[model samples]
Target: MSRLPLAALVAAFFVGLAWFVSARQALLLLVGVGLGSVLASTRFSFTTGWRRLILSRDPRSVIAQLTLLAAAAAISMPLLARFPTELNAALGPPSISLLVGAFVFGLTMQIADGCGSGTLYKAGLGVPLNMTILPLFALGSFIGSAQMDWWLALGNVNPIGLVQLYGPIEAFGITCLGLIVLALAALIWSGKKTPWFDRRLLIGAIALAVLMGLNLIIAGQPWGIVYGFGLWAAKIATASGFFNPSHNWFWSQPDNSQILSQFVLLDVTSITNIGVLAGALLVSAGKPPARAPRLTPTQWAAGLVAGFVMGYSSRLAFGCNVGAVFSGISTGSLHGWIWVPMAFCGTLIGVRLRRYLNFSG
Candidate 1:
């Protein structure tokens, strides 16, 4: 039927998938879908006639970000203030390690032409090179996790105690429902500054908020894409002779098992990313996936290497854009704001390079 309905159906399935799996996971994937949809909105190359369909400064992205932040704080504050456990979940603020890790991630996003969510969404669009890069990203994550103890030893900065705020807000299905509306209103209002608020913008915002809510209800956390795939790849690679014995052994524990035990910790999240690629392919099949003078083998190789850096750095930083920025902001973490500006700078530099290479505006 309609594109939005299809996305909703996919989201429904994603929620079920996460529910059957684990709440913790669904939460991360929801963040992925939410942000992916908003980013999807931003990718619209507005035309003169379709100005209304285009966005005003494409502000929905910021709206989604802000809506999430406000809703998260509104809910989270009460939860932290009343219940100690909920506060505990949201308190792992970034540290020196986080800053260092995030900056490196920024650099990698620039080189790879995709961050965590960006990579999965682009791959969803059937960018063949993205498929290649996904595995490299996983390998990097495995490396990072394997050495997580070392990072912690170096004062990775774990905020163990809760910085509690106010009351006890529900953390499941109902909460997801409440925030979805807020995200939508924020998006529509945010469009005021742009060229014009269009139907796609409105429809897309609601649909996306729905997607985010589903992920939260199902996964019990935010939606995250890149980290999972990259992690999956890392487990596979370390075991495949690409790395040392110890590297593969830990990840292999769950994955290597047969019957009643499998190690697809982020399986549903990966599928969520799969849905993004499918959505983009369906939308852009009428057009080429890449610009003219498409990337050469060397550039493709560079992209893959860069993707690896993102994987490693994102894991170290505790989240990528979707997790660190989207979910972090949604949870009202201060570092989330810090991350966006840093990432935007990276994007600007990348855009400049793209202009230099492709003469694109």
Candidate 2:
């Protein structure tokens, strides 16, 4: 696809969305494009950042991530505080499922080489492994959501909202302080040799933060990735009569049922997801195609399984790195805070698994 045609197609799609859907959805498509472009151009990957930190004691990517969290928290917390009714936070309960799920998600992401956002953007950039994982990820996400009630039943508590409990000012302060502590820990872990910052990653972080704020303002919710995947799977399953939303606890909710019946374009997350794909395609037009990793049959099987498990675990954990960690922490949800350490522990094991599988990027 040439850049000129790709750009034209994106414009046409935007116009069609505005005409057939709504203006808000159209704008969200643009935001998604910006997100995809930034992520692709900067190579800002959460999975890679953590992996780099673990294997080489590099703190640059990790530091950029912390900066992103701090910046997002700075923007999102205050807006959530003021518009409590209009906006929604990405809150998930502190539960046994959360702990187990986050850990498993972290582990699988390393083997699969992508989290939710990572998967999407990589797929957009035409990475073969991620493209293969995309459908499996959707399937696992649907299954996880279908079984959410059982997971919650195992053990959980009501979600804790720091903004609601401590006010936005205090919540933002806490968020920033925590990020600072993490940054310092990363720096210490990396020793004196590793650089503390990368200008490209810092710019990407700031861009993502601003776009996330725009997402909240227009969509009335923080940015998310997993739910959209699950929803896509649900739509297909229900249509094919392989699954019944009416029988599923998660999809049986009034709002969930409503969206299930509507066009996918009407869904905020879905439209943005489409936009992200389009944006990536647009950006990749003139650039050389990214080289796909070479994998043995066993390695390929391992990656596909990891992709499915990553999807399922993300739902169990309430979100992937993007939905659970990024959006979760930024919006003052306590589960986001809990998600980090457990996922990191999983990553510790995952990197070893990645080596054992002989998967290389």
Q: What is the lDDT of every predicted structure here?
A: 0.54, 0.93
TM-score of 1: 0.64
Best by TM-score: 2
Model 1 residue 247 CA deviation (Å) reads 7.1
Predicted candidate 2 versus true structure: per-residue lDDT over 1-361, tens digit per residue: 7889899989999999899889999999999999888888899999999999999998889999999999999999999989999999999999999999999999999999999999999998999999999999999999999999999999999999999999999999999899989988998999988788799999999999999999999999989999999999999999999998898899999999999999999999998788778878887887888788678889889999999999999999999998888999999999999999999999999999998888774
Candidate 2 structure lDDT: 0.93
Error of model 1, residue 47, in angstroms: 20
Whole-model lDDT, candidate 1? 0.54
Regions more than 4 Å wrong, model 1: 1-64, 67-93, 160-206, 238-261, 265-268, 281-293, 296-302, 345-361
